[model samples]
Structure formats: structure tokens, C-alpha cells
Target: MSNPKTKFSVLMSIYYKETPEFFNKAMQSIWDNQTLKPDEIILVKDGPLTAKLDEVISIWQEKIPNILKVIALKSNLGLGDALNIGLKECSFNLVARMDTDDISMPDRFKKQIEIFKEKDIDICSSWAREFDGDETNIVSYKKVPKFHKNIIKFSKSRNPLNHPATMYKKEVVKNAGGYKKMLWFEDYYLWARMIINGAKFYNIQEPLVDMRAGFSQLKRRKGLKYALYELRFQKELLEIGFINIFEFIRNVTIRFIVRILPKNMVKCIYKLLRK
Candidate 1:
């Protein structure tokens, strides 16, 4: 209720395989913990979830009544499509992204809204503290540059913002072509398009969200399939002129090598890369 004048919508997509306990905690962080509550929370059920997940949604629905909106999909659509669909249903111009298994700091929205009010930026995300079993036990910090120009330079090599900790202008996202189906690089791909379209970007230096990260998450980053996805995404960026041939070549070569490496090596590399 701190920034009641600046209303925004929370957009999240959850599917099966996510535990109910994590989902409940995510829901709490967005509402119960936040200083500036969202006008509406758009929960896109990517597909049929477990009875337990459904039960948790039911409990929240009754608890919040009109504030929580559920858009259940008939079948499983991946994160990009699910978010694109949910984006259109959002009631506000500003939309904050959340994951089903992450934790947002209590002042996350308040801080981001202040940036939007003061700057001419379209999208912004803060640094995220990656944790494992408990929120207090921080494993690493996924940090990004603070200014738009630095962010633009950084995007050529890596994602310049944390997706789940982001709050973006809905129209800016739509104008940049929204989210696309880019497998493991969905968010990064959309960001490349937005950068090409000259959308302003910023990142807060402090960690505004606590992201859940572990060995399983690191393992998912490897394998032949993920390497292929990275290759395709880099090719798309090159084709769109977002990155030059040399940049594309460098990206593909490094990312491909990392993806095909052993999971333990990948973990160490990621740890070193992150703060």
C-alpha cells in the first residue's frame, strides 16, 4: 500500500513439477511481504497442475477474492508463450514478473516503481541473491550493470537482467515483439529484440529478489539439446543484426563449449561468473 498511486500487475506462469510449498511461498512474497501490493495478480497455470497446486490456488483465491486472477491453459505451453498470453490479460501498464519458486524482497516493487517514476526507462530488474535450501543461505549473486548503456553493452554477451526480479512496461514489451519461443533463451531472446528496438533498460544494484538455484538448475543448462538451443538463439540474434558476425561467433563458441561441458565444471564457471 506504500505506492498505491502507481498500480501494477504481477504476472507469473506455473506448470506441473513445481512443488506446492514453493508456490505458496512465492504467492506470499508478492502479497503478504511486499510494501506496495499489486492491483491484480495474473497467475497463468501453464497447464494442468497437481491437485495440491490447485488446492493452494483455491485457498489463495478465497483469501484474496478479486485480486488473484487465474488463467488456466488447456494444455502445456512453455514459459514464453504462457507469459505472452498472461501479459495481454494484465490490467496495468507496469507488469512485474515472478517465478513459482522464488522469493521477492519486501520492497522490490516499491524500489522499481521509484526508478520508473524518475527515469525514462522501459524495463528494470535488480540483482538477485541465489539461494539453495534456505533463503538466508545465499549461494551467489546474479548481478547486472546499473545504467542503460552498460546494459546494452552487456546484453551482447549475456542477459543483462534477472527475469524473475524484473518489472517492465507492458506496452514497451509488446512493441518490442513480446516474448518468443526460444527454449532456454526465451527471456534473453526477447531482451535482444527489445534492445534492437531501442527500448530503455536499467538494473538496480541491490538484490531485490532471492532466486532458487542449485545443482539441478545448473545441470539443466548443459546437454546437447541446450547447446542446440543456444546455437539457434545466437543465430537469430546475428540474423536480426543485434549482434555482428564476430560477436555471434564468439557467443556461440563460448556458450556451446560451456553447455557441453560437465555439470561440475559448469557449476564452477557459473559460480565464478556470478558474485
Candidate 2:
């Protein structure tokens, strides 16, 4: 059983481009489907949402009342900034990050809360299963190391945590500078800082959420622009002393090639690599 006293908040940001149907499903998972519901849900409107999106949100708001806190932005602030704003409104120390298009398993929050109760970690995230069009069609699993040492080492090369499935201590993240605008590498950069700051980490061995992914996600990872972003992000890692010169070169070289490869090749590589 989960501890009732260990209250947590679900922090989510939705922008105009997200599908209304997806957003509705996400809300159902966060509230209706959870075994252990959040004490509060901070939903950040990155910008003005479409009428359809607003309709879904409105229905949730009416259903949950005070538990659903909506923060509206005058214009789009992007995920990092939008989340930073939402963090300020969270009433609990533990905050779970949820993507607008993802589905949280019924036991996701319950299991995470149990881990927090038993462990001394500052952050905890579970493996996520990626599904293309629906939850039944799982494409891959995004798994991370289960302990702090392995997580630290893994951070030197790739992201050490699944951002959307993460539950982190609010003060620890804020002290580590919260989230920054690093294009596609925002979560990765934040993990680097947290690791450098000596924050403890842990990962559940099984998938706790279903992430929506497909070729569109892969497309965003390709192109010269994405390759440049990878280079810049890697350079930032070196500058911050999180990774040494050799690691920087190796990381950038491999990522650069992968980013510039044909989309079809990348897809094959992803399938081959992920379990």
C-alpha cells in the first residue's frame, strides 16, 4: 500500500499544437486512472489552447475543482519555461512530470511514492514504454540504470532519466537551477546539473507510463539543426566540467552521425537498440 501522507503533485504543460484527444486521455490517466491520485495537479497552459483542448480541460476542471490548478500564459513559453512556472504552484515537495500526450499506468504514482518512502533518493523515474498510435502497440521501452552510480556514469553519454515519467523533489530541482531552455536537451541538461550537485537518483525497473512516439519524434531528432543542437549541448557539458574532453568528442561524434543519418536508418537503429 502507498502512504497517504506522502502527497505529490502532477506538473504538466500543454501547448496549442497538442491533440485534444490525446490531452483528454492524458488527463484521464492522471486523475481517473491513477491508483493514488495527486494531491494537486498544476496544469500549465504554455499558451492559449484551441477550443477543443480548452473543452477537455474545462471538463476536468469542473470534475476535480480545486485539485486542478490551471496557470495560463499570455504567449507560448515552451516546455522548460512553462514547467518552471508550474513548479512554483505545486503544493507538495514531490512533483511528477507528465507529458500531454502520454498515458500514466494506474499504479505509476503509487509505486513511485512507495519508493520515495523507502529510499533516500532525490529523484526517481521509471522505465517508459513507447507506443505509436495506442497503448496496445508498444514500440520500445526507454530504460535507465537503477542505481545512483550507474545513473551518474550514464549521464555522461545519454539522458539518465525518463523526464515524462520522473518524480523529483521540488527543492532539489529548484536548487539545481530547475529546467533551462536547451532546445531538445533541456531534460538532459537538468540531469547533468543535478548529478554535479550530488543529487541522489533511482529508477524503477518496469515501465510506469506509456509514451506516444513515432516517426515524427524521430524526424525531430534528425536534420542539420538537431545535429547542431547536439553539438552545442555537448559543448555545454564540457564547459560545465560534467564531461571531460575525450568524452565530449566521443559523445558529439557518435550523436552527430546518428543525427545526420537517414530517418529510415535511424528508425532501424532505434528498434535494434531498444528492448
Candidate 3:
């Protein structure tokens, strides 16, 4: 049973490090450009933010403060914990996850919502256009599976869902134990858990989000410490039966090499191999 007029909530978290310009753009894309506006928006302030960030928030508050629910965390919890907190505050059965920097297209919500109304999907994500320097010079498009069976199979090797472009049933997430503190693998870990628990997943065939990409994105993926975190993620999946010990070791081996490689090399491989 689906409501054609179902109103959904947008869940987002903002930290001090994000630039105000990109933040404003993301906000404008959601509130000003979307074909169907969100009913409620649950935003978590991860920690103290700059004056510029505050000013941008204030502007949004002045525009539609009633539609916004702001939750402030005393300390900087990472995305997982912050989102877990925000989830409890969201008042909709359908919740759309939004990143602070990515821009959703005008019809993004309209199209996603229609799918929810027409299908039995527990989580629905979409393709994304990755851009760097400028949106005009779009580098690559991230295309994902359009069916549940394909998504589950793909999840064995890598995350099948596009995180920021996803709209999920809130109960599905809560039942999956909400998001956890998995360092860099928070979203992937949650998706993996949901899949093992028999959550139905889908992905739209068209790009609904413009993912911000560039040097900073590449920089975050390197280092020995990151490799260690990735290995920990794989081991947890093995313990949960999402992967076997053999698959776990193989994942760790590949992750260690990829995570420790130079940023330029990683970027080259991504651009060359990533479709």
C-alpha cells in the first residue's frame, strides 16, 4: 500500500569543514529547484560550525523555518552517529538521505517518490554524475543496478547503492540498527546489513544527483590507516555472513592496495575503470 501524496523527510548532516558556497548550492537545489518539495527536513549540526555556515542556515530558517527541524550535537560525531540521531527525529516513513555538497536535480524527489508509490522497494537509489572543477566538465557517471537481485549480487563485491542519492523506508533503516560508527564504511556497512536481513533494494536508471568530485575526494581514500579501517569493515561483514573468510581476505587484500596507492594513481584508475 502506497500513498500517492506521501510526504517524505530529508535527512542531512553538516560539519564545520564544508564550504558555505557548496552548502548553499545544495540547499538551493533541494528547496528551490526540486519539483516536489520535501514535507520536513531533519538536519543535524554535527558540531560547531563557522559563522558563514550559520548565516546560510539562518537564511534558510527565515525562508521556511517551520518545515525544518534542526538538531544540534554537542560534539562532532561522524556521519553514522549523526545520522542515527537524525533518524529518530524524522517524522516520515520515507526518508531521503542528502549530503551537504551534492546537488539533486529538479525532478529527483518527484521521480523517486513515484517509485516508492508504485513499487515495494525498501531502499531506492539512483545514478549520479560525477563532476570536478565545474559541473560543465562532468567526468563520469555512476550507474547502478535497476533490480533487487542484481543489487544483492553486486553488493558482494562493492556497495551497490549510491548513498547520497538514496531514499529509504525509515523502518528498514531502524530495523537494520540504524547507521553505525564504521569509520569510512558506515553507509556500506549499513547497506550490507540491510541486504542480509532481506531488504529489497532498487536503483533508478537515470542520474538524479550531481556528485561533487575532485582532488579532496581522492585525498581521503589514501593512507595506511584508511586501509586498516577498510580491513576492519570486511572482517565485520564476514562475521555477519555477508562474505566468507576467503572473500573477506580477498577484499582486504584489494582494499589495502587501493587505499595505500597514491591519490593520482587511484584517480587515474577510477576515471579509467569506473563507468
Candidate 4:
């Protein structure tokens, strides 16, 4: 049953120039999830709408009466700015994040809200599978416990909560100053800021999303750029005292191993354990 007191606003910032099919899949997943239908579905089109995308959005707008607003940007602002605009327009107390090229499980929002109510958590997220074009090459992360201290441990290395799978209290986000216009990795920065502001986080141990990887422009960029971002991220975390030297070394080593491992092997291991 939907909780009337806990209305959720789902914010999807999309640029469907390349993969309209994936965007449709993502939106359908949310629409099909009956237990936790969003009070308002805020789709922020980050650039001028193409005919194909316009048709899709129009159909959805008519089919889903809950879709409260569609903000079509006249000019392209990057993802961070687009998300900020979406956040500003949300009317519900709980805000959920969605990505254009991912598939969310039907029970995602229901499970997240249940956790939020039970634990009084400010932010809730879940584990997700990374599918590299092929579903056969799906990989998942270890299930972290739902505690602020445990979550803070992984903050220095990589994002503890999958960005697309996260749901947060709207007021908590505003209090933390919302998303910043970082060059990249704005989600990670936002998580760090939220944690610093004494917001509690929880990760439901389930594969709530299937995120397609290695297809975006961000993935096509030179490997050196990603390395530089990680270096900067690590430095910032270290300065903030979230990670010690030993944890830092361990985290870096694990990431290195994942990079070299065969995609299929990683997928198999993850699926086996996740089940």
C-alpha cells in the first residue's frame, strides 16, 4: 500500500539523443512499480526535444497522470545543473533519483521507503548490477549494512550508495545545499556533503537496478581523466578524515583488480553471491 504521508517525487534528468529505448525502459520500470508510485514524476529534458523524444514524453504525460511537470531546457546545461533544476521543482517530501539508461526493479521504492520508516534514515539506497551491454556480463557490489558508520567507511573509496538507486529526504538535501556543479562526479560530492551534515544513510541489500555501463560519452573519455578524478576524490576524502591510510590502500587495490578482471568472471561471481 502506498503511504500517503510519505509522498515521493521521482526526478529523472534525461538527454535521449543516443538511447531512447533505454530511457523508455527506465521510465516503464518506474511506471510499472505499483507499490510506490511517485506523486510527481519530474522529467527534466536537458536539451531541445527531438521528434522521437517528444513523442515518447507526450505519450507518457498522457498515460501517467502522476507526471506533474516536464521541464524542457532551451539550452543544454550539464547533468549537475539539470538535476539541480529538477530538485528545485520537486513538490514531495521524499525525492528519488533515476537515470535515463537504467532498469529499476519494481519493488525498489517500496523497499526503500520501508527502510526509511523503520530506521529513520535520511538517505536510502540499494545495491545494483552493472551490465556491460550484455546481460551476461552483469556484476554487483557487496551488500553493505544499513548504518551511518559502516557507510562512511566506503565513502573515501567509491560511492557507497549507487547514485541512481538512492532516495533521500527532500529537506535533508536542501539542508546539505543540494548538488554542486562539479566538472564530474557530482553525485559522489553530494553524498560526502550529506554525510558531513549528519544525515543518516542506509543501503538495502538488493539489486534494485541494472545499470548499463561503457556506452556513455563519459566512458568514452580518455582513461587519464577518470584517474585524475579518482585522485582528486581520494585527496578530498583523506583531508576530511573519512579514510585512513590502510583503508585507502585497500580500496585502491580492489579497484585495480576489478579493472583487470574479465567482465564475465566478475558478473558470474556477483550473481552467485547476490542470489
**Residue 37 alpha-carbon offset, candidate 3, angstroms:** 0.6
The local distance difference test score of model 3 is 0.89
Candidate 4 per-residue lDDT, tens place, 6-85, comes to 77899988775647777778888888654677888899999886788777778788888657489988888988899989
> How high is the lDDT of residue 273 in model 3?
50
Per-candidate TM equals 0.97, 0.97, 0.96, 0.82
Distance from true location, Cα of 258 in model 2, Å: 0.7
Model 2: residue 183 alpha-carbon error in angstroms: 0.4
Tell me which residue pairs clash in candidate 3.
none
Instruction: Please give the ranking of all candidate structures by lDDT, highest first, separated by commas.
Output: 1, 2, 3, 4
In terms of TM-score, how similar is model 4 to the real structure? 0.82
| Backbone clash total, candidate 3 | 0
Deviation of model 1 at 150, angstroms: 0.4
- Candidate 4's C-alpha runs over 4 A off are 1-5, 16-18, 134-137, 141-143, 214-222, 238-275
Worst 10 residues of 4 by lDDT: 214-223
Question: lDDT for model 2, on a 0 to 1 scale?
Answer: 0.92
Q: Give lDDT tens digits, candidate 1, residues 1-275.
A: 45448889999999999999999999999999999899999999999999999999999999998899999999999999999999999999999999999999999999999999999999999999998888788989999999999999999999999999999999989998999998878899889899988899999999999999855578777888888988998899999999999999999999999988887788889889985
**Model 3 — TM-score against the truth?**
0.96
The C-alpha stretches of model 3 lying farther than 4 A from their native spots are 1-4
Evaluate all candidate structures by whole-model CA lDDT and list the values in order. Answer: 0.93, 0.92, 0.89, 0.76
